[model samples]
Target chain A: MEVVKKYSETELVQLLQQRSGNVFSYLYDNYSGALYSVILNVVNEEELANDVLQEVFVKIWKQIDSYDSSKGRLFTWMLNIARNASIDMVRSKGFQNSRQNRELSEDVYSAGGTSETKTDQIGLRKVVYSLKEEYRVLVELSYFQGYTQDEIAKMLNIPLGTVKTRLRTALIQLREIIKP
Target chain B: MDIKAYIESGVIESYVLGMAESQEAAELEQLSRQYPEIKQAIDEFEAALEKQSLAAAIAPPAGVKEALFSSLESEFKKDRSQGQVASINWGRYLAAASVILLVVSSALNIYFYNQFKSTSTAYQSLLAEKNTLIAENQNTQTKVLDLYNSMQMMSDPTVIKISMTGIAGKENNLATVFWDSKSKDVYLLPNKLPDAGANKQYQLWAIVDGKPVDAGVMGTCAGLCKMKNIPNASMFAITLEKKGGSATPTMDQMYVAGKVG
Candidate 1:
């Protein structure tokens, strides 16, 4: 029998609540790749990204019982968790070294598909690198490190308000640079 | 309201990216409610960053998923209900407990070793007593040899000899009081005196026809005490005195009375 893929997150969560392994297996098979994609973006190491992927799923399993439907969708929550885990790795000394070279993979979609949206990749990389060195670190901490602005401020030992200001400044600079 | 400038700042984008400090985070959260457009812009920024980073995705290690699931499954089951996790590895707990036990036993072993050390202290004290007695015996032998030589010298016809015997009131205490009148040297061999107690000393007295004269103080002895010097007296007696000795004996407390003739 052909299995129907789930589109509604609520049904997926209900299936998870019933403690069904098939639903979990399907969930892993489907979202694992996307989660790994998020992990790789921040950790930049295939092995570490994979490790984070496992952690992300495990965390979901442990904390799933506590999920409330009122707190938005599972996708949003998962994204936050995945993003946070990925960023955590980037902040670590081990993953920090993985940030060098091959800006935007240079030759990325020449192989992945025919869309040739590589220009967008180039623009994003240029926008990020265009940020001042301090702003770049702040951006990396916020975006790639998955740290909240307060976390960024504390990690950098700066004022909480300054983190917000720098983030505002950096995003404004990026918007100007990548106006296209 | 400078609302247009605030919206233009792209702080909304940073807030959506989870990059805002608390002040900014709070401002952005409030603004996300104020302007749905700001929220929409944040979503767009999030999507772009996601796509950009997704290109760098790497495959994780094999079986890591299994390990994570196992831990999560245990944690979830134990949390949702009350039963202990049977599937949890016993080796980890056992290893930790064993390490703690080893530390405690090591400390206990040190405590016992110190206890054994105090028991040896008594053995050290007994060994000290044996050494003291050995030295005392050697000194006494030398004194006896000197007394024999003195007797040989006093046998000369020129040396005077006197015999001192205890009086009736002190029959149990007597001394062979020898004297050389010309040399003024004497030896008092005292026996039958009670043993001394802590801090009390014995004194000797010389009597010339019932008048007591001073003889040097004598050392303590339960058996025999030998004292030197005789002051041409007809009698020798023993008395107890203070530690150093009194200038004169306590006549009423005299333990032994003797006459030397």
Candidate 2:
């Protein structure tokens, strides 16, 4: 982790309200990687993910005032924006027309060439890859795709109760893998 | 609150993954606010999810960060320009106010200065008039005292008063001589006489037992003037001479003559 300078949540909120560019730049430097990963995971294409990533940041900058600190962490709100923007992009006609040539089952992380070379350099990335495919796919659909439990159940053709249990199990497994 | 039952409900995980239904999310938000255990569970799951996302972190194309920053910079620059315009408006107001103040003060200064100058001129003229009146009043007072003394002299019986009529073809010129025999004092009062030329004055002479003795030169005499006393003088005469009187009288220049009775 690149230990960027940290600000308290209150200070961060105030800075964002002021629309301070320095804070925004610091936010881009620290969180863009994670946001890009979530974006890349949803759209599963490099060019599409890049376009979606830009839209996500622009929306965040333009609509930062709507963020409510009481609702969730700043990162969580940004993640929701990124996931929603990526999902919206994936549904667009242009993306559908362009992406029809590629199979849906293609690996999401296979496009970023640096991920393969740098996977060994970062310990957390190697640890997360050890996550079982069954639970990883559940985490992806629920978290990165912004799918509601009902939607996830219908899409996966599982019971509504099973969708919740499976997402919970996926989170627990990820928690185990993420622990130091 | 049963922390174990709440943890087993999978609501925390659903909330963390953004998979919770609107109602479920609302209920979880309320529960989290009420129960610290639910909040803690959600935070833990969120942390795990964040970790997993970070693991998948791909350095975004470098161009995206530049593009995002440039957009923000342009926005801030736009805001600053508007701010400058606002500040410029206040500057214009201040400049106009100061100009008005300067104009008003200058006009007031000119008005007051003109008033003061006119008042000072009036005061100077009034002071000059008062000085001239004081001088004239003093001259009048001197004349009144002289006339009063002359009246007293005329009333004394012992004082000899002689009226000298103009002689030498000058009949209109007249003079008076008052003699106090006991005190041997003589006073001449020059009356009508031709105007003296420049550098010339009227001189009076006394005849002491027939010889002429110089008395004194006289100017325009509107009052009594004491002449030199000649105790044995039998007659007196007036003649015109240079500004400073001569050693001897010019008998041919005699304008008036009188004899003691």
- Chain A TM-scores for all candidates read 0.60, 0.75
lDDT of 1 by residue, B1-261 (tens): 466687778766655454545687777767666777766665556555444433333335657667766765654454433333333456668878899899989998988888778767877877888888888887787677766666675576655545444556766665555566776675555645666566767777777666766677776432233455665677677777887777788876577664554
Model 1, docking class: incorrect
Off by over 4 Å in 2: A1-7, A10-70, A89-103, A107-129, A145-168, B1-11, B30-36, B47-158, B167-172, B194-197, B207-212, B219-222, B247-254
Clash list (residue pairs), candidate 1? A50-B60, A87-A145, A149-B20, B234-B260, B235-B260
lDDT of 2: 0.75
Model 2 chain B: weakest 10-residue lDDT segment is B75-84
lDDT of 2 by residue, A1-180 (tens): 443559876787787778776777777888889888777666767777778888888888888899887777777888888878988887788877876544433433342453233432343334435567666556655665556677767876879887777667766665666653
lDDT of each: 0.62, 0.75
The number of the candidate with the highest lDDT is 2
Kindly list the per-residue Cα lDDT of model 2 for residues B125-238, writing each as its tens digit. Answer: 999999999999988888888888987876788889888998858999999988887887888888777888999998889988788888888865447787777677888899
Judged by TM-score, which candidate is best? 2
lDDT of 1 by residue, A81-157 (tens): 78788767656676545544333323221233433233223323335655777786776556664656666677778
Q: What is the lDDT of residue B52 in candidate 2?
A: 62
DockQ winner among the candidates?
Answer: 2
Candidate 2 chain A has its poorest 10 consecutive residues by lDDT at: A114-123
Over the true interface, candidate 1 deviates by an RMSD, in Å, of: 6.8
